[model samples]
Target: VTQRLCNQIAGKLNSRPRKRLGFFTPQEYIHAHL
Candidate 1:
């Protein structure tokens, strides 16, 4: 159970950065388009 919880936390931590990066890229793209 502890291992599973740890893995879930790790997965969220990893994906959080990726999600932020994706949002940033789109915002940059819109700025460039404008």
Candidate 2:
């Protein structure tokens, strides 16, 4: 896959909220920890 496509996929995954984090996006959860 192209680098652009890889980045797009990662962005989408990171932006999705997960039940594991009280419905917070992965990025949001990470930023909170930091």
Candidate 3:
């Protein structure tokens, strides 16, 4: 895939919060816990 496509996917994944992660985005979870 193109770099642009990968970046888009990564952005979406990172922007959306997950219920399993206590409704926090992955980045937020990492920052709070790590």
* Model 1 residue 7 distance off true place after TM-score fit, in angstroms: 0.0
Q: Which residue pairs overlap in candidate 3's backbone?
A: none
Global lDDT of model 2: 0.94
TM-score, prediction 1: 0.45
Tens digits of per-residue lDDT for model 1, 1-34: 6999999987766544335456445545556678
| Model 1 residue 14 lDDT score | 52
Top-TM-score structure, candidate number: 3
For model 2, residues 1-34, the per-residue Cα lDDT tens digits are: 9999999999999899999998999888989999
**Ranking 2 against 3 by TM-score, winner:** 3
The candidate 1 region of ten consecutive residues with least summed lDDT is 15-24
The local lDDT score (0 to 100) that residue 6 gets in candidate 2 is: 98
Task: Tell me, by lDDT, which candidate is best.
Answer: 3
Candidate 3, residues 1-34: lDDT per residue as tens digits? 9999999999999999999999999999999998
Residue 30 error, candidate 2, Å: 3.0
Error of 2 at 27 (Å): 2.1
Better of 1 and 2 by lDDT: 2
Evaluated at residue 15, the lDDT of candidate 1 is 46
